[model samples]
Structure formats: C-alpha cells, structure tokens
Target: MDDTCAGEKSHLFCGFFLNFSLFGTGVVYTLTSATSMRAIQRANCYHRDGHDAPCSVGGDAYYMFLFGLAQAVLLQIPGFHEMAGLSVFAAVMSFFYSFVGVGLGVAKVIANGVIMGSIGGIPMVSTTQKVWRVSQAVGDILFAYPFSLVLLEIELINTHEMRFDQMKDTLKSTPPENKTMKTATRASLVITAFFYLCCGCLGYAAFGDGTPGNLLTGFGFYEPYWLIDLANLCIVLHLLGGYQVYTQPVFGFADRHFAGDAASVEVPVPMLGKRRVSVFRLCFRTAYVAATTALAVWFPYFNQVIGLLGAFTFWPLAIYFPVEMYLTRNKVMPWSKQWVAIHGFSLVCLLISAFASIGSAVGVFGSETS
Candidate 1:
C-alpha cells in the first residue's frame, strides 16, 4: 500500500480495512463456532426427542465465551510459525465437513427424486426485495476471495528470514515466488470452487427456495443426526484454528507497532527456567477476543454480518488497490487499451460493491430493527 499510494492514505485506509477485515473475521468465526456448538446440542436433542420436538437450543453466549476462552489461550502461541500444525488440522477438518455437507445434500436430492430450486431462486415480496437479496448474495460470494492480506504473512514464514535466503539461493533452479504463488493460488481456487459448487448446488437442489442459510445447522437434514453432529464438530474444530490464522497478522502488527521490546514479564515453570511473556500481547489479545465474542453474542445474524463485511471491503482491498498498484508499477498509460480495460473492470467491480454495500447495510440494519 505504501509503495502504491501517496501520503497517509495507505496508513489511513489500507490499515483500517486490513485490521477491520481481520477483526471482522474473528467476529464471524466466533459467531460460527457458537452456532456450530448450538447446532450440535440441537442435533442431539432432535435425534433423541424426535425431529418434531421443540429442540430449541437458545442462548449461544455460553458457547461464544467458551470459544473466546479457547482463542485467548491459542493466541498466546507467539506467531504464525507456531500455527503450521494447527493450520493443517483446520484444513483437514474443513475438507471433512465440506464433503459431509456435499454428501448429505446429494442424498437428500436423490430422495426428493427431482431437482428443486428455480432459476430465479426464492421469491420475494417485491422486485426491490429480490434485488436486495441478490445484492447481498453477491456480497457473500465476494467475501470468499479477500485472502490477499493473508499472503502478506508469507514474510513471517521464517523468523530469521532463513526461508527467503534459501529461496534466493534456489532462484536459479526454482520458479520465482510470485509465479509459484500464482500457480498454488490457481490450483487452490479450482479445488475450492469444486467444493463450493457441490455444496451450494446440491443444497439448493435438495431444498430449493426453502434451503436454509446453513445446510447442516439449519436442520435441512434431520434423519442423519449423528452426521450433523460430526459436521458441526468439524466446524468448531476448524474455526478454532482458522481464527488464529486470520488474527495472527493483527497480533503481530500490534506487537511491532505498540509493544515493541517493552512490556515483558517473566514467569517460572516447573521443569523449565523462567520464560518471558509479553504483557501487552496478553492483555490486547484477551481484550480483542472478548470484544469479538461480545459482538457475536449481541448481533448473531451470520449472513447479514458476512455480507456487510464483504461489501465493505470488497472493492477497495480486492479490486482497486491491486489494480492501481499494477498500473502504477507498469506505468500503464491513461488512455492505453490495457489501462482502459483494467480501469473499466475496476469500475464495474466498484459499482457492484456499492450495490452490495447498500443491500448488506439494509440487511444488517433491517435484521437489527426487526
């Protein structure tokens, strides 16, 4: 951002958006974890008491606080380097649950004997309402693509910069980092799109316009209660580590900018000698977790919150900055074909983002009011 933008705009806007996205992710993850926990309880209740029973597992506050406590402990893991194992575990759990969702959806669709859902999707009271829903749906989709900031954590892959030095040594034999990253990104996108399409299309086909926002947790499938429990468990486990992945960057930044070399406290262990802990990291991360949990408890509207965050950050962080930086780097002429095409694309995305923002704002505020 500093390389591309002038003056303090980078710090003001980029810093704000980056931190906001990370913080917002923590909030979403907290909500999701609580929701999943509640789903597990409700699933069990419905299974034992029958699906027709009122298995209303209300009050996610306890679950939210539990998740927050887990985060508070995990965030003390120092940095992203320590989270490699956790990341792998989370990835595995994510794939496990995604497959479960897909499989369940397929089974339900098969039982239904006909593909459900119309091309227009669920009908609304008015055209305006339908447009709002479509816009919010666009925002939800856009939310999945803003991991650009996560790539910045590549800098933290090694503490002593050994990784970069090793890469530099292998530069003659190996492809450049950018090319390798792009290749990995493309492959990941393909894999992710496959699962996303399977889960989404299958869920819609199974339940049509009446499909719940969440397939597993929304009681879309009741017969396989044990499977739902397992899926929700996977979700909880995944979010536990996924939360750390998104928040580590923010924690690192705070350590650098605010804490620095100060605020150390030495605590002795039973077997090991005294180890120094950052007093600042402890307090800040704890407070941050608590805040996210509180917000999740207060406004538990999952889809609405996601849409608002996505719509808020999509254009600037995902489209505009990258486009502007690319143009600036290559010195693309203002009236040139390449420049015009890129700018046109950005413009279209900006309009879409604006539309999404309005719709998401409506959803969030409307949900709150109602």
Candidate 2:
C-alpha cells in the first residue's frame, strides 16, 4: 500500500463511518437515560389509572431527538480532545447502566410476571421484514466488537504502545495477524454478545412485544425511581465522552484538509488578515452536528435509525471497503475461492442492509405523509 493512501484516505473513510456509528451510539445512550426518566413518570401515571398501564411504557422517542440537538452544542467546544480523558469514566458509567438495566428487567419479570414473557413471545415477522431488521440489528450491534477495530487504529500513533520508529511503521506495529489483537478482538465481541443477550432476555421477558428501544426503560421506574435517575445520569456522562472520541478524528480530518497540515502546524486562514484558525473546521463540524441533530429531531425512530444507518453506512465501511482493501493489498484474485466467498458474502450483506434501510425509510416517512 502507498504510504499516504493508508495515511489520509483510509483514515478519512474510517473516520466517516466510525463517526456515523459513534453518533448513532451516542443518540441511543443519551436517549436511553432520558427515555427511562419519561417511562418512570409514565409508570407513576399508570399506577393511578388501571387502563393506562400498558401504554405508559411505550412513550414516543421523538423528544429524545430534540434533546440530542441541544447536546450537539458540546461538540462545538474548541478543546474537544482535551476532554477525551473522560471516556474512561464514561465507560465505567456504561458498565453500571448495563448491569442495572439487566437487574431491573429481571426484577420486573419476577414481580409483574413477564410481559408476554417467553422465547415464544418474540414476534414472527415476514421474511423480508426479518431480513431488513436482522441486517440493521447486526449493524447496530457492531458497537460490540467491531467498534474496537476503529479504535485500534489509534494505536498506530499512540506513543504508549510503541517507541518512535515503531510508531512510524503502521503495518509492522499493528499487523492484522497479531495474536494479542486477535484474542482481544474475539474475546470482547463474545463478551459483548453475551452481555446483550442476557439483557435482552430479561427486557423481552418483562415487556415482550412492547419492549422499548432502550431495554433500560422497559423496566419502568415505578418502585425504584432512584435507579432510573442514577442510570440516566450515567448515560449522559458516557455520551459526553463518546461524542468526542468519534468526532475528534472528523474534526482533525477537516482541519488538515483545509489548512494543509495538522491543526498544530498552523496555516493562515485565507482572506482573514492572517487569522490562523481553520474556519472551515468550525463550519464543517457545526454543520455535521447540526445535520445529525436535525435528523434525530425529525425521524427519531431509534430502531429504524439503527437499521437505516447500518444498511447505508455499514455495508460500505464494515463490509465492502475492508474486503476490497485486503484483496488489493495482498494481490488476491477476484476468482480465488477465498476472495469469491468473502466478497460475495459482503455483497449479499450490502444488498440486505440497503433494502432494509430503504424499507425502514419508507415506513417512517410514509406514516407521516399518510
């Protein structure tokens, strides 16, 4: 691979899709906590009226989008990378919420008698619908292990991982065949999958068909409102940190592309009396955040957004580019069995993800038009 090809282009595409995934993940987390608080309030209302109980938990997810727009202001801060250290604490907060969510779901099942409460309660959908949702679901779930691959790319320039010369050599320092990377990657994925399944089982058992997009909210903070408040607080903090990690690369990419070098290696802004700020940096990030926030405010269908983003973004980022890059790097033939099977499978996934996104877009928008 040409040095600069892997350098700028790979990072650009990686940042784009990686940020897409991160932004979506941020919305979900921010929404998760906010939705739980709403659910808690609704649960209180339901307690007074016997007929309103079932409807209490399925609150519309739109308000969360509005909140998302408000939070985007944080992305506009000048020293975003400085706050990146908070990600560690944010991660810890995430662990707490995940555990608490599972616990609440389990308790709900035991106390209220599972919602439809069984494996059988999982609704059967048409094959086409299943294909769309399944593809979307898998794409959303990429937050699990595959998300780490994007993060791992940072190790290349990270001085903590290597001395000076090693930092300069990306392929050697972080080879795809590295055993430690392979093990960590596989283990994190399995653990994440198991964690999600456990949480899903509990939530599904408690709410069944009415399970909220956020499993945490499905617990409905009736008895222990404190838990709902606490968990949501954690989510907010986590999202603050997450938004930066995903967008910092994007911010850097734009700054460099426009300024002709890294932000630190100052280049003069044109037509500004030698003002040094990368003004494109400001407009670019602000618009990106605004656009995402607007999308959130408009549709705000959490599951549907997941499906659409996965289908639209993941097929290219997660499936096609990586496979094509590998083949081109290794001089592998399209006719080779390994190439044929892997690339072919990628194509199939891309199709399914695309169709799923389209189907979801129609469903979301069609409802409004009608």
Candidate 3:
C-alpha cells in the first residue's frame, strides 16, 4: 500500500511541473512575438520609399530601449504597492511624459511638416481623411526623414562656423504673410496639441490611477470594456491625425519632383477616379486609410512604441530647432552666452529624459516578469 501511494504522488508532481513549464513558455512567446510585430510595423510604415530609412532603424531601436527603461522606473514610484490602481495610472503617466518629452521633441519638424501638409491639402486627400493620413504622415516625417536631416544638419553646423540661427534666417527670408495659411497652421497646431494633452491625461488617469482596472469593481460603473474601447478610439484618431500631417507633403513633393514616369502612373486607388478628385489625391487618401488601418490593427499598442521613439528624438527638435534657427540666422559665435545657455538647458532636459526612459523600460520588464 505505501509503495503504491509513493508512486502515485510522484506522477502527480511530474504532471504539475510539466503544466507550469508549458504556461511559462507560452507567455514568453506571446510577449516576444507581439513586440517584434509592433517593431516591424513601425519600421515599414515610417520607412516606406526608403525615406529616412537609417534613422527609422535607429529610432525603433531607441524606442525599444526606452520601453525597457520605462519599465524600470515604474517599479520605483512611491505608493506603488499599496495603491495598485494608482500605480497603473502613474505608469501610464510616466510613459506619456517619457515619450512626449523625448520622442515628440525629436520629431517636431517632421511633425510640423505633416501638420502643414495635411492642412494645406496634399494633392489627393479630402478634409475628412484628416484623422489617419495626417497623423501617420506627421509621425513618419518626424521619425524617418526629418530626424535624419536634423542629425546631418547638426553635424554640418558644428563643423563649420556657420550657426544654426543663420540657416534659419536664410530659410525664413520672408515671413509667411498669407493670413489664411498662417491661421490654418496655428489652428491645427492648437487643436492637435489640445487633443494630445486630453488623451494623455485621461490615459494616465485611467491606467495610472488604476481607474481602468477598478471601474467595474470599485464604483459600480459600467464594465471597463467601454473605457478601453474609448481609449483605443482616441489612439486611432491620433494616429490618423499624424498620418495626414506627414505623408501628404512627401507624396506631393515626390509627385512634383519625379514628374515623368511617376506622374504617368496613376496614384493607386479603387474607384474614385471618375469623380472630380484628382487621381493623385484619390490614390493618396485611399492608400493612407488602408495603410493606417492595417498598421493600427497589426500593432495595437503602437502609441506606447511611438512614445518611446519620441522620448529620444522629439525633445531636441522642439527646444533646439527654433533656437538653433534663431542663432543660425543671426550669425552669432558658437561660444556666445546666449547660445551656451539655450543649448545647455535643452541638453539637460534631453539627458534626464534619456535616463527616465531607461528606468521606465526596466520597470516594464520587471512587471512582466513578476
């Protein structure tokens, strides 16, 4: 009887161990596959047409690195253990700050260009195609093309005595006095900024404060499903907005620059050619929608990945670009007091952001592990 019982116990233990191992392996596989898919999607969307190809790769890697860093920082927030709900909120907020501070700053010009193009009406898309095409285009320009240009420009400016301010002044020889264009651009920027701020704050409140996870249990509110859906919708809109801002300009420029063969080839689209819409415009809008949807579905949590990219790339562009342009145009000495102070402050912010991103990424990894 005793011998039989011992054998049965051993069999039970072996079975349990096998099940546990399988579960662990499955979880790791899911996370790995998801991460890779997201990264690849971002790469393709931004690096299409080989524009900003190299920077896209570097930017993607940097985003992944920051994600790891963000994971680390979230682990250390105060009251994290006692307030599970708040911990999530804090985590969300941290992610937003890290990305906006870093990624948004780096891609400001591309972001600006996309915004300009979307508003200015890139040949084919209607105003309604506004959400997807504009947002994605902005994202692409900032992460892929403008980033590469900025890096190259910085190198050139550093080597030569020619200041970045001078370059800006030369570029800005005449102020854009067109009231309509100026008004539209300003309006677009303000609206976009407000939208981003609201979403970021709400996202932080829901996830960081644990409201999203707890809404069902704590307050007798409707299921958290609604909130998640709403969040996703907001993200979708944001993506669309960025697409229009960035992609339209590039498409327009391409059409103009490479007129012969490229021009003859009808912009790719299904039926709308018979309508009054230009073939180029129709193709642009249709392509933008399809691409945006495909990418958003393929990489559902792209906002996080984008935030990570922004963390490294966005900040420099935001603070440095305007100032650099100012200095370059004025032809000031590189060592001037004004130059030192402005660049110094911007550099410090960038450095702190880099560290924070690293910390947050660590926290994310730890959470997944635990």
Candidate 4:
C-alpha cells in the first residue's frame, strides 16, 4: 500500500482497538462490581427486602445506548469547532465537576473507614488502607483516558472469543441450535466496523493530509457539525447513567449492611455537607459535559487528538487487565513465549501512539500560528 493508505489503515486499526479496549474495561468493571454487590446483599440477609440488584449487562447497555445517541446528535451542530473562546471556562467547569465527583466518592469511602475504625477502636492507619487509597487515585487518573482504550480492547477480545466458542459448539453438535442472535450480532458488528472505518478514514483524510481547509472538509462528514448537538444530548444521558452506576454500589452497601443507628450511616443529608457536595458535583458534571461537547464541536480537528489519546492511554487497560485477571483467578494461562510477544507488541504500540499524539498536537498548534 502507499504511505497515505498505510497511515490511514494504521489510524483505523488504532481507533478500533482503542474503542474495543475501553468498552471491554467498562463491561468487566461493571460486571465484577455488580456480582460483588449482589454477593454482599445476599450475605447480609438483605435479599429479602425486595430491592432490585444491579447488573453489569444492564449498566453496559445503558451507557452504550447513551454514547451512541450522543454521537448521533453531536455530529450535526454548526460552528462547534470555532467555539474555543469558551475553552478555558469549559475546562475549568469540567475539572471542578470531575473533582467533586471524585471527592464525594472518596469521602463516602473515608466515612465508611472511619465508622469501621470507631467500631473496632483502632487508632492507627493500616497499610492496606493506604495502599487502597493510592491505588484508587491511580485508577481514577488511568480511567480518564487509558481505561477507555483498555475497555475497547477487552470488548474486541471477548467478542472474538465468543465467536470462536460459538463455532466450536456448532461443530460439536449433530445439528446446530438457532443462530439468529449470533448472526445478527455479527452482522451488527460488521456494519458498525464499516462506519467506524469510514469515519476514521474521513477524519485522517481531512486532517492528516496537512492542508488548509482540510478540517472544514472533514467536518462535513468525518466530524460533521451536528455531532456537537448530538454529543451534548448523549453526554447528558451519559452523566445520568454514570451517576446511577456510580451511586448504586454505595447505596446498595449502605442499605444492606448499615443498621439504622450505626453512627456510620452516610445518608444524604439535606442542606448540609452531602447536599453541598451533591450540588457541586451536579454543576461540575453538567459543565464538563457541556464543555466537552463544545470543544468537540468548536475544534472538530481535535477529534483525531481525542481518538489518539483515547487509544493510547486505554489500550493497556482494555487488553491486559482481563487477561491478567483471568490468569490470576484461574491460573490457567501459562507464561509462555506468546505472552512475552504480546507484551512487547503492546509496549511498542503504546510508545508509537504517545509520540504520534504529541506530534499531532504540535503540528495542529503550529499550523494555527502560521
């Protein structure tokens, strides 16, 4: 293939890989958390209360639907890319909002810790607690971009494995069972992949060619003006889904385990500490969603940057975590030669992606200056 064609292919591959990785991570985390929460509810004899438990499948589907819907809207808005005059405000708002959400989540955990300590009369910091807090912060930062890529990788791997398993089962049977769902799913995958490929190609063609007005041309279809409006709506739904998913575990834990007068009841206090925090979180997340939508709209050219960052950071989280978890849990996958090769490949891809992102950022800025 020619250099341009090869570059386009590489970009497409990276985009698909990243999306699959990030989505996969989301699925795994949601499922595992749901399963653990369910077990906790059962063990505490709280299952008899008739409360509906959370499920990973439901959460995943909800977020996916929201994301798809948002993308559809965001691609249709005009002047979305030139609104960078509001970038600083948007960024600040998003940062504060994200910070509040993080703080609230952390505060709840700390409150739980304090209550446990009070019950036990323990006065010292435990090594596990320190490690956990540090790990949680690291996880938060990683999830910001890297985790998305990782989730996408996991999704792709899981899908491939499922297909393989289905094929194997069919071979083993005298007559295969109805393959309607599997066929439809595969068909959907093919169609989605085709559209994604087209978007990636159009994005690269519009920007990667390093010409004037390329961005405008690309935005016509690749980054389309309407995407901003769509993104805004999608983001709002995403935030709602995210809030639900994030709060469900904490609510579940509190409801099932905490007794009415346990001094550890971190119930939502009206017009007090909890309310203040909640308001801040709501404002922040709303601003964040708005800003992100605006940025994507105003600088349609940045879609490539977003894609690159999403792919680079999240690829490891998506592809490696599940494999690591599976190996740790089952002790089935031996550390063979193939494992070494995969790790090496992952590392190289990461480095390339990182450098390319930096280079692209510099180039975009340079072009604007000249």
Q: What C-alpha lDDT values do all the predictions have?
A: 0.84, 0.60, 0.37, 0.37
What is the C-alpha lDDT profile of model 1 across 288-328, one tens digit per residue?
A: 99999988888888888888889889888888887877887
Best by lDDT: 1
Candidate 3 lDDT tens digits, 1-370: 1233235654444334332322222222222233443434433444343433442333233333333233222222222123333323433543443343223222433433422222243343565444333443343223321232222222322323234446566754332334434454455456545545543343333333332211211221222333423333333233222222223333444356543343323332233342233445445444433443333333333323342333434444444444555666677678889878878987876664465444333333433455
Error of 3 at 15 (Å): 59
Q: Looking at candidate 3, what is the lDDT of residue 160?
A: 36
The order of the candidates by TM-score, greatest first, is 1, 2, 3, 4
Per-candidate TM equals 0.91, 0.71, 0.37, 0.32
Segments of candidate 2 deviating more than 4 angstroms: 1-73, 76-84, 112-184, 219-221, 259-283, 329-333
C-alpha lDDT of residue 117 in model 2: 53
Model 4 over residues 216-319: C-alpha lDDT tens digits?
22122221223322333333434333333322222333334542433322324434333222232333333433443343333333323333344345444445
> Which has the better TM-score: candidate 1, or candidate 2?
1
At residue 173, give the lDDT of candidate 2. 50
**Cand. 1 TM to true fold:** 0.91
Superposed Cα deviation of residue 200, candidate 1 (Å): 1.2
Better of 1 and 3 by lDDT: 1
